[model samples]
Target: EAGVAQSPRYKIIEKRQSVAFWCNPISGHATLYWYQQILGQGPKLLIQFQNNGVVDDSQLPKDRFSAERLKGVDSTLKIQPAKLEDSAVYLCASSLRQGQGFYEQYFGPGTRLTVT
Candidate 1:
């Protein structure tokens, strides 16, 4: 199967500006996730979606970040008034349901955002 796809492989934006990233998951996948990975650290789960409904977003910064998967096939993440601390690689991943839980995830190349 094809992997997840993300647009704007790299982006440069000023602090306090707004940016949006898009992701299209593989066909037939039931779960999608967005992650933020900073230099020298593990990827942090920002939000998760099962179909068009959000499954988890405890780690997401609700004040400045928002995401949605309206039709369960494609998703978008946006950051308003971006911060310097927000500079990182934003990753999109998807997985197929296997038995009781989701299976191995397939990841996209990610959108590298540099907040200036």
Candidate 2:
């Protein structure tokens, strides 16, 4: 009955500082995702993992951002030398099933990061 969970409910960092985030998806879920949401914009998918394997990450800022889902249960996202533009809410989500069919993706209480 549990859902996704993210750590450090909020974070504040200076420009060029590094930061890390953690997420735990619902049990039995097979797909996980990470997204970035700006103050006034819709969440943008950053990366996706399907059972310990990466499915998509073309939108991720490779130069400074990285994410991994180990053992297909827990996931972590990190940013190094973060830019001010990186200020946003980092959201973690998971779905019980994923594919061509429609399924619900549950989201966690996002990690709000502020860059100064």
Candidate 3:
């Protein structure tokens, strides 16, 4: 099975600018997720999608961050007017399904964003 794929791998941007990251999940997976992992903290879920429909996005910062999984396959995350504290690793993950009782999420290497 193919693992998750993410791009750029690294980014540096000034505060108040915008940045975006992309992800492609493993084949045959039914659930996808995006997470923000700050230094010294575990990944925090930004959004979750199940076959193109949003399952959860309560933790996402509406004013500055947005994401979408259009085809239930590839996904993108965007942060506009970036803040200094937004510097972190944006991780993408996928799983079989929520009901499978298998919460083991396979993660991508992640895109590390730095705001200077």
Inter-residue clash pairs, candidate 1:
none
Query: What's the TM-score of each model vs. the native?
Result: 0.95, 0.96, 0.96
Clashes of each: 0, 0, 0
| Per-model lDDT | 0.94, 0.94, 0.93
Root-mean-square deviation of Cα positions for candidate 1 versus the true structure, in angstroms: 1.4
The digit string of per-residue lDDT tens for model 3 on 6-106 reads: 99899999999999999999898889999999999999999998978899999999999999888888999999999999999999999988667657889
Q: Order of all candidates by lDDT, from best down to worst? A: 1, 2, 3
Query: Candidate 3: misplaced stretches above 4 Å?
Result: none
Candidate whose TM-score is highest: 2
Q: How well is each residue in 1-116 modelled by candidate 2, as lDDT tens digits?
A: 98788998999999999999999999999999999999999999999999999988999999999998878899999999899999999999999766834878899999999999
Candidate 1 similarity to native, TM-score: 0.95
Where does candidate 3 clash, by residue pair?
none
Model 2 bad stretches (over 4 Å): none
